[model samples]
Target: MDNKAVEALTEAEAKAELAQLAGALAQANILYHGQDAPGISDSEYDALKQRNALIEARFPKLKRPDSPSEQVGAAPSEGFAKVTHVVRMLSLSNAFDGDDIIEFDERIRRYLGLGDVAPLEYTAEPKIDGLSLSLRYEAGKLIHAATRGDGAVGENVTTNARTIAERVAEGRKLPDIPLLIDGAPDVLEVRGEVYMSHADFADLNTRQVARSDKQFANPRNAAAGSLRQLDSAVTRRRPLRFFAYAWGELSAPLSDTQMGAIERLNDFGFQINPLTALCDGPAGMLAHYDKIEQLRAALGYDIDGVVYKVNDLSLQGRLGFRSTTPRWAIAHKFPAELAWTHLEAIEIQVGRTGALSPVARLQPVTVGGVVVSNATLHNQDYITGLDSKGQEIRGGKDIREGDWVQVYRAGDVIPKVANVDLSKRPEGSAVYVFPDKCPECGSPAIREDGDAVHRCTGGLICPAQAVEKLKHFVGRAAFDIEGLGAKQVEQFYLDGWVKEPSDIFTLGERFSSGLQQLKNREGWGEKSANKLFQAIEEKRNIPFARVLFSLGIRHVGEQASNLITRNYTSWPALITAMDAAAACEGVEWDNLLGIDGVGDVMARSLVMAFAPGPERDSIDKLTGHLNIEDAEHPDIDGSPVAGKIVVFTGTLEKMTRAEAKARAEALGAKVSGSVSAKTDLLVAGPGAGSKAKKAADLGIETIDEDGWLQLIDGL
Candidate 1:
């Protein structure tokens, strides 16, 4: 919401924005993947995702459990039978510019411990803008085809896929996908993209207009809808094509390198991209990318960007993967298109944090094949033609109503006003004025020092803030009550059925027996009402971390919740600790701060939230109706340092501080940043300061880097 650059965000601001981003992205995934319709442009979605990544990079410890960075696509549509992938179909990280590509190559080299001079080859190819499909074959015969639906599971479209293969076979040419291949592995799963050529897409639309059906927005959408049709007859009529670029599960190794593997797939009667080439390094990769970009317009189908992967299969194996993406590969996207549009008006929307975010209403214009009617104004600073630091931007040209502005969606996924045209500005136009009062609740909007945007002083009194908070409470990362979505939350709030989270638990008990029953409400029936009540009842017992995050406390994100709960183990323990730490000094405060990644700012926020007040009262009321489970402990049966509170002081020589902490945590150890009375072991390195002296004074066991390594050796 605050366009004040990712670098300017404090830990608290980043955490809050991350929560909002997670929810938005979750909805986007459902629209794009599950429903075969996207509400936002690809550039807009990419911008939001890129912003999420940037924030997480700056505040790694604040990364939420439901962070969009850890997710891919959406759950499979209910219409299709589910197919669980043998190997998860992960996505690739994106590189927007040449610098990003350079950093990507450098990161891979660093991860694999390869020198700059080392011959680390890479394979570069076009990144197809289409639906991902996995075709599984056994004994050289096509077994099934599945669409990538949320990475781990997919939608089975075997019948629809077979129709395409059959049609290709009837053409009397080499089939795009041979129903049977010779000399293939006993089991093979080829991964590719299903796309429609521009000419074919035009023809399909013409047919759709003749049939009086809804016209598709783009070729990608048309191809997806056609392939995912329940009736294979519908799919057989559509001009769909496949380009094999990767693999999923294999009975044996296809080749020693990525390019070789693609060649092998081609030999097995799959249509491989002819442009796929081996690049010597980053330079060659970029060169090939440029060539591909020049050829993109004439390629007949859609390609959003160029993909680069570690060519050597062994190197790729060594690079491994993150939670939802391969570490060895990245997509270098082409630059976004630019267009000019009129700034019709600006509207302010308040967030759950009470920050007033401005949105730009624009005259609808097409940019990059998508119609854009709106853009993000970010904040008052962005609208006023200055950054948070009071520096001039757009040559100090402030945005005004009735002005023509240049719009672009390159770095940021959200279309932004890049520049204002002074010559085209209306004669009567005046500089835009930001509001000093909450637009929704008439509360006084105040801007704090060092903050970029204005926040409403009103807490729950503001309907906008209250509704957003309620939505967050029922978010996928929080309580996650089934059948309780954002729309339901808003409807219930407007009807005054649910005001606070605790009120939700008592909805059935009070409303079900009253004259104004939920069953009789508009668009509701007894069965649906009963199902909603049952879903709400099921969430009465929730995990401790979810409970903490569900409260929507400032500076407390999913990771912070996990860290605090893991330390205290139970709700009562955390409450007791917070009560003690409210004094702001002593062992309690130190203990709270000692938790790795929990800074003074976050500690203060936790203490304030738990102090006696309306916030604490609400939390108490909510907890009364629910069973709060203890924090889950990792399986540490064979771990040497399980349940031990370990601290690292000064510097770590063998590994980075973060790496050391991660390794220690993997072995079931609590890696604290500061040394406290509860510290079981201290791994002190060079320049060990007050922390080392305190550990000695407390008579805690201290060890050097070598000793620490020796202790965990062979574990």
Candidate 2:
């Protein structure tokens, strides 16, 4: 968002923007924190957060309780057991410049009631751009290990840690961490970063390419994914290194100062960063930061910034912490690296939802040690130099091919176009025009109000959209046919063998009947064709939720589809409800709307989709060829919330709305966004508005989060 647009936003607009920001950040947290894969670049995520904080400062009262500021990383995934931290693993607030570092020191001094001239000592260390890990030792034996997930709780990876230790014990030397510290205290929690060196990362990527596994985007992600493996053998095989810099839940104090403690840790056989140093004041800290910045490329591992913390443990205690971060420490981050490159061409790609996304093909240039050839345009507005709110950006200057564009890789993630240098514009260059028609089908591409995307109107007719939908059907989260991938899906669609969701199941039968010969084509052999056919046959008995998601309806994502399927349970039940709801507004429609996360918009989209038309006809045709299994309720014996429809309303004090919903869903409850008669429980907190009143009038059971805890505890 631009400054002009930010300044001109109304209270309502700000609230809407905040909600959107919260949702996007939450999804990013899930992808990055829970799944160990990030969907957005660090710069994009940081920009959204900065925008959210600024808007909140301007309109504090309009801030939602589920604001990103109040949350840490996402809730832990179900793959591992949850470990509640003895001391909350806090995240650090960031500083972008030398002035911010000076301010941090000033604040620390003021907090300690010390004079500005007094020498406030500090320890400056490279802020490792990797996964945070806490290793707990009881009686000098490593007992517990976890990732820093959401601060309060983390995923238990003790087995994985022990496997690494066992491998190290077998005459194999890993990186310099002491898996078994001899002189450690009775109860010591050694907190540090788990990172992959440049050489290790390159070797791992080479192996990934050889094995046909998905390559990690960066060293940080590689380290995280490697460490979080459920199977300890996998973690043991990875080239992982640990650097201890902090402590948690200690039985005894290591030293009087932070730098002294780090030294003690090194003496105790932990690998301490050689770059970590004691600084007298801000000048020393800033100099060390600059020194680290200069040495960053040669360091062999990623360090996005330098962290400065008060040396004296007592002074640090005096400074204390804010809600999420400590006031005694700050991370002074490095500026993003940008390089100028020529834009070769602009291409539009169609998404599964039919939205057209533009990509910039740039002349390959090195940015932050990575080769950059393409960057996302986000939408047509970005290409036209307009913000999503249609406000002027970069003085309304449009980017064109052959322009010298600045491309930057933030946190060594996705490369993006930062700016275009118009001074070197080519002769006869004109403003690039986005296509008005769909490139694949020549259909009118229209942009709806309040949406930043332009979508093709030809839903089924457009080959791009149809092929994308087919690919989604066979996606890892969907049918997951092993031999049939994007290439096969496109080829099948082009060959007129598969055009819709149902056509996939008929491919084997058609080939058996001599109607289509798949083995005759290039890239298709007898064994591969048979494997593809067998894979298609295996997906014939699919679950209801996956089938719903495979249909490619807008606003109905995997989670939403799961909720809908769990509520209806069967294909016949869902069809009956949708058919009844489409005819008129009644109990069936209200119940459909009543599903906890189903809002009016989602309900309308679903109902309209299931109404008599191509969509309904396609679904009906698809179901006829397969046995759609009923959604199975999770096995939560004696749980009070099992199979219940729950609606959470108002500002939950103990947890965010997302947290409450995620928790409820984990316990086998349907979390509806709105309250309705079908809702079995109403979780109302302070400031609950109409939903609370509606629930009360409907005689639904109402309870607060504390009551929720009591109910789950009783179970």
Candidate 3:
């Protein structure tokens, strides 16, 4: 669907579009985070996410449980052993312009309840465009290293990390990530980006071609792939570098402020970004961002933006975190880089949701040091010189097949066509026509009432949709079957050997019985076939959350599935609850809506999926071949409020409502917005109203703000 201004969207429209945005953002995360390749330009991704956030703000109840606004990177790739971070590696929210940075500062000040002209210090530094790595040291000795996988769990690349500090650069010995340090804390986890210099990347790619290996697309991908290598020797020869920017787990405080902490890290033999500096306020932050953008080309490494963090450590503690990002920080991305390239052709690609997305094939041209051969055409309206609202763009000039176009990559990942050079259009070149049928299945494609893009009506019959769904089922965040990736999924779907999620489980049985002779297939050997079968078999007994996420239901994603499964615990229970809630009115429906994040729209989607239908039949068939584990609960053993449903009401004096909620959650309490029969405790502040009275009527334990604070004192 085309993005409309948030204010223009009705509640219903906002709800529908939010679902589409959630799915798009989720797929983008998988490509960028799990596969180290991004299919959409950074600007496009940010726009979609920003739109989702705006819509959520306008219609708060429409926010989906798996809303992109609350999600971080995709789950870690399954190639390496997973490491659960002691403290989460959160992602930063983005800002595109100086106005956004100013608003960001204003928001921080307001959240901290500061006056309009409050002096709040901030630290600004270059945001490196490379892999995020966290190094752990215990008892002053280097212990292990991890890559930020899904913020919570990461990939263990300890051996490979040890090689980063062994290199020399610019006639100076690079600081080693010291194996041991004197007077260091009992535990420390330094977080930073592992990058490859532009020179090193070129040399490595040259060597790769000489060795008959595939050349990397860019330095970021090259650095990530090298550092994640199973063999440390491979990493040792890659000339990878590190710059410590933040910390994860710390046994003690580094300093009282962000800049001081960085200086402390530098004192302990870690390279700090030389341009990192303290900014007085929003103006200073913007100035530093501009300075970094100017110095970007000379940095010898990839940097897409500048990061700003509130300098005061105490203020940061009060600001706390949102679901996925910290309120105390944001990344102000540099503006898009523009370059002219030939509009070779436009190709329509069908997505799993049946949306026909247009891609611009271009003659390769370098934009910001990366080759740009493809750009997003957005939709039919975009190509026809009109936006989603039928407003003229590019001065009402249509993009033709042979026109020279301007492409831009805002964050140096994916490039998109921004403008067309009408004067350079080839004579007799035709204005491109978007397809009226699905390219893969020849089904009738129709644009919906409020959507911008055309969608195929073929449903499960559409090969593109079916294949994509099957791919998602086996994706890293889902079944994650080894040796079975997108390529394999497509191949299998075309071979008529796998049609649905259930078809995968029966592969081993069918092939073994000669329904298909796997060993004789072109790229298949007996050992490989057995290994594929073994991998599929291993995933039969999967977690409930994965099973739900693998189904590819509308509006249901990893977080949504986890939220549902955590509340329901098991497959049978969830199915039963959904069945009861399908009627849309009852205690069951209320309870489903009461699951904290699940709203009416999401609840209805779940109910429809579980009701008596083709989808449910398919789900049942898939479940028949596997063992589904119950949801795993978080460990809150030592907290006083563990498992308690706590409610905070009225205006808090010491902390903002957001901060109070975060603190309560951290202490193992389930913070609810309203008081209910299930509420165990109520923390009422000044001006407590109906909720406070309701808690008192329910005979729940009631406490003032000081009493609430004292209850969890020193614990």
RMSD to true structure for each model, in Å: 4.7, 9.2, 3.6
List where candidate 2 sits over 4 angstroms from the true fold. 1-41, 44-299, 305-335, 411-414, 513-525, 648-666, 683-693, 702-709
Ranking by TM-score: 3, 1, 2
Sum up the clashes in candidate 3.
0
User: Which has the greatest lDDT?
Assistant: 1
Candidate achieving the largest TM-score: 3
Relative to the true structure, how large is the alpha-carbon lDDT of every model? Answer: 0.83, 0.78, 0.81
The candidate 2 region of ten consecutive residues with least summed lDDT is 167-176
Give candidate 1's total backbone clashes: 1
Q: Which ten residues in a row have the lowest lDDT in candidate 1?
A: 408-417
lDDT per residue for candidate 2 within 1-715, as digits (tens), equals 3456677776656655665565556556766777776533455556666677779767755554346766677656556788989998887777777877887787676555678898789899999988888988888878889988888789899887665555442223443455667778898988999888898899998999999988877787888888889888888878887788999998989999999999988887777889999999999999999899999989988988898899999877656665467778888877766788999999988766678778889888765544567766767778899865667777887889888898765432235577888898899997889888999899999976666667899988999988988987875446767677767788888888899989888876665742337667776777877777887888988888889888867656666787789899998999899999999959888888667556566677788889999988998898898888999988788778888888888887765565566567668787777777778999888988999999989999999889987888644
Q: Write the per-residue lDDT of candidate 1 for residues 412-484, one digit (tens) a residue.
A: 2346787899999999888888999999999999977656668998988999998998988997558977778
Give one digit per residue, the lDDT tens place, for model 3 in 224-326: 8898888889899998888899998898999999999999998888888999999999889888888888898898998888999999999998888887899
Query: Which is superior by TM-score, 2 or 3?
Result: 3
lDDT of 2 at 449: 62
TM-score per model over all chains: 0.83, 0.66, 0.88
Query: What is the alpha-carbon RMSD of candidate 1 to the true structure?
Result: 4.7
